[model samples]
Target: MFKKLVVGTLATGIVLTGGIGSASASTEGVENTKQVAPIAQKIKLETNYSSTNNQYGFTYTWDSNRQVYKTYDFYRHDGVFASYFESEGIKWYFKGKVRDLPGGGALGHYEGKK
Candidate 1:
């Protein structure tokens, strides 16, 4: 009976400790919040185009103060008006917001025409 009890306790401990679970089970819910933390920082604009895809772009630098978020703008040959938008995480433009992504696809400072 004592040996059986010991074996039972060992089995329970192993299960509880995830010794017999899949590799992913160990990190089931332990999220890396730090990794998701907003990377707020200044960015250097890099791109040149009149009205084409990949017109204007920027590379953000790590900043100790501030959570970097996406900033959108329209680019036009004439400096009249500009459209603006913002987002965090992947892809500044999402499926839900696809409609909001400007039709003609202007770059840098969106204006009236949508």
Candidate 2:
């Protein structure tokens, strides 16, 4: 009976320890997502017309201090639109669309991470 009690206690302790570790990992993941959301939200691109290709495109760079992305250039093209920028030893790229906004300006969507 004593041996059985010891084995059961050990098993329960192991399971509880694992559960605590998993909870901690989950919390860390949530915090990371929260941090990344703001960075991603700050990305913006300005629209430009390319007379050559007759398509619209945009270019931008990441501003770490201001937490905003600055547009550098834009052009029109076919196929997927892509642009590259480097910040703090990390290389990032933006890939998405450039479309006309009903009111006036142009809108772009790009995704990248550093």
Candidate 3:
């Protein structure tokens, strides 16, 4: 048992030291490393469309106004409209608590609620 423990410790030390040394050595050319261009931001939506609302398309209903003009709004990250809604002219929009995606998975019914 003692021999095994010692061997294990030695192996771990060797691995750790090798990793650290290699990492340090790799930094030797840091000054000559090419500057990487900023990666384009990508938005990944786990789910799109509202199941309960039976709505399609990217737009959503902002408000219901007695069968008049329904208000609509859109959700955008960095000015890109990811989601939107349509409703009466009342101009409805998602609240602060609304989830980024539709359906009740993230925020439950609260996401569909006004």
- Across 1-114, the per-residue lDDT of candidate 2 in tens digits comes to 999999999889879887545655445445456554334466455443222112333455555554555443443333334477554443445545467545554444543344
lDDT for each residue of candidate 1 in 7-90, tens digit (9 for 90 to 100): 999999888877865434355576683477678998765442233334345332322233322233433344333233442332
For all candidates, the clash counts are: 17, 2, 14
Best by lDDT: 2
Off by over 4 Å in 3: 6-24, 29-34, 44-114
Which 10 consecutive residues of model 2 have the lowest summed lDDT?
48-57
Task: Tell me the whole-model lDDT of each prediction, alpha carbons only.
Answer: 0.41, 0.50, 0.41
TM-score of candidate 1 versus the correct structure, residues matched by position:
0.18
- Misplaced by over 4 Å in model 2 are 1-61, 65-73, 83-90, 100-114
The local distance difference test score of model 2 is: 0.50
TM-score of each: 0.18, 0.22, 0.24
lDDT of 3 by residue, 36-94 (tens): 77889886533333322334223333223323222133334433332334432223334
Q: If ranked by lDDT, best first, what sequence of candidates would result? A: 2, 3, 1
lDDT of candidate 1? 0.41
